[model samples]
Target: MTDAIKIDVWSDIACPWCYIGKKNLEKGLAEVASDEDAPLVEVTYHSYELSPDTPVDFEGDEGDYLVQHKGISREQALEMADRVTDVAREAGLDYHFDILKHTNTVKAHELVHFAKEMGMQDAMKERLLSAHFVEGRHVGRVDDLVELAVEVGLDADATRDALVSEKYVEAVRADEDQARAYGINGVPFFVIDGKYGISGAQPPAAFSQIARQVWAEHKEEAAAV
Candidate 1:
């Protein structure tokens, strides 16, 4: 096992629970920050589109999309959205369900891969989620993605060129294929040490406990080696 515990997170910008899971993971890390023997953790965010077929400029709102895709009623969709917003607030995330522009996340995922290449993956992911869920920004468009990347200190022209040329499209597809191999049909899935899989938006205390358990096993393995 590696010295630092490797965490590969599969999430999408359009996924509300994914953002919550990201925050919970950080909170868990904070809870274990003072542990002298805790293994250092390194996270890599992988792409997983919640709605791959969503068009670049979807004409409907999130409620409509949910009704069509998930076969839920409009009222049910709205209720789910409200519940998600309330849950997000408890995790310190402001979710604007009414204004969120529902659209394809392929371009946003590509931008995440581009940001990963530039060592700004975390910033880019956060910016994209904030733009999608909180600010109602169009995450599927090149111009908006470039603007978000620039806001996160990435070079604007380079980002635009990368998007224009579709530099990281293959990387996004590869992540999706890997998720398939793992039989993962959800976003915000966490793969710890490339072995343990944790699904859904678990609580911070759960993540903290898992981290300690993983760290203990890691130490034992290192000693045996």
Candidate 2:
């Protein structure tokens, strides 16, 4: 049996549920860690852009973007944002959709790839999500992304150079291609053991249950082998 259960998460930085899903997954991991028989957990975040064609500097706020892109009425957009805000709050995130800078997340995904090389991918992901959902920061711009990378203790110059040079652009695209191959059409999609697929921001208990089930299946296969 493998030493750890690998989890590959395909999500977008601008995705609010991705952030909430992240928090819930963390909670679930913590819960499973308390179990003596649980396998070690390893998570890798992959790039998935929900709005690849969005402008780097969108003129309006998140609601406007939703209304325009999602073909929803202005009132429906507000209601949707409010519903997500409450859900995010329950997951311990402070979402400020009113101030969110709805922009393209391709550059942000590239930065995440750079951080993964530097062993700071999780920190970079958390910072980027918070910057967008809670802090209302522009995550699409190179200068702004550089600042965020520095905040996570990555070298400022190297971060800037990587993004400016488009060093991780291919990595970002490769992840997207893989996502398509997996037939994943949504953010916060979790692939457990590279076989079981879990969608959406599931609660902590659900994650714990899945982890235990995977471990059990591994044990059964090992015994048969």
Candidate 3:
């Protein structure tokens, strides 16, 4: 049997580019799914908070947060959001930045770790991103996080308990530590087989080409062994 390709992703739920990159990467992986020779690909998501200092209940909208965070004018922040919204639309994502709740994502990250234990990590990640970007829901609170977890087929009470007790705080911190060790300063970063690192939201073709190349190299190395 051919070995699977490991794709480790570091991203935050509040990141717009991370969602775009995820969709594009999925599209890229789909491009080679029908090829019998293609090796399996396994994706593991890690925690990376773009704005760890952001408050759980920010007093303003995304533009307001951006203005303070990026030190840009309100006009410039809105323009940036508009540009990202357009790009997100092209990726089949409907991003409603106007209604987005710009909140700290540490709790959301912990929820993802809980889902990982339940074998629903990817679903939780998707839900959190959509909740934050598309649905404009609050993800920084335990109540909201628990609801999102339940939506992904996780136990509600258990989810609540986990969040309240901070069951996955260490796990989240560990992922962050690993991210720092890797010198990763950005989200939507892809580490392929723990060797090749692809930064930012790349084109779908880029993901397809790299996956195929990695699988081919893995096959060659196996044969040589």
Q: Please name the candidate that would achieve the greatest lDDT relative to the true structure.
A: 3
Cα lDDT tens digits for candidate 1, 1-225: 448888999998889999999999999988888788656898999999888898888888878988999999999999999999999999999999888898888889999999999999998998998888889998999998888999999999999999999889999999999999999999889999989999999999988998999988888888999
Of the two candidates 2 and 3, the one with more favorable TM-score, higher being better, is 3
For candidate 2, the 10 contiguous residues with the lowest summed lDDT are: 215-224
What ranking of all candidate models by lDDT puts the best one first? 3, 2, 1
Q: Mind giving the per-residue lDDT tens digits that candidate 2 earns over 14-115?
A: 899999999999999899888878667889999999888899999997678988889999999999999999999999999999889988899999999999
Best by TM-score, which number? 3
Instruction: Spell out the clash pairs found in candidate 2.
Output: none
Whole-model lDDT per candidate: 0.91, 0.92, 0.93
**Model 1, residue 177: what's the lDDT?**
97
CA displacement after TM-score superposition, residue 163 of candidate 3 (Å):
0.5
True lDDT of residue 139, candidate 3: 95
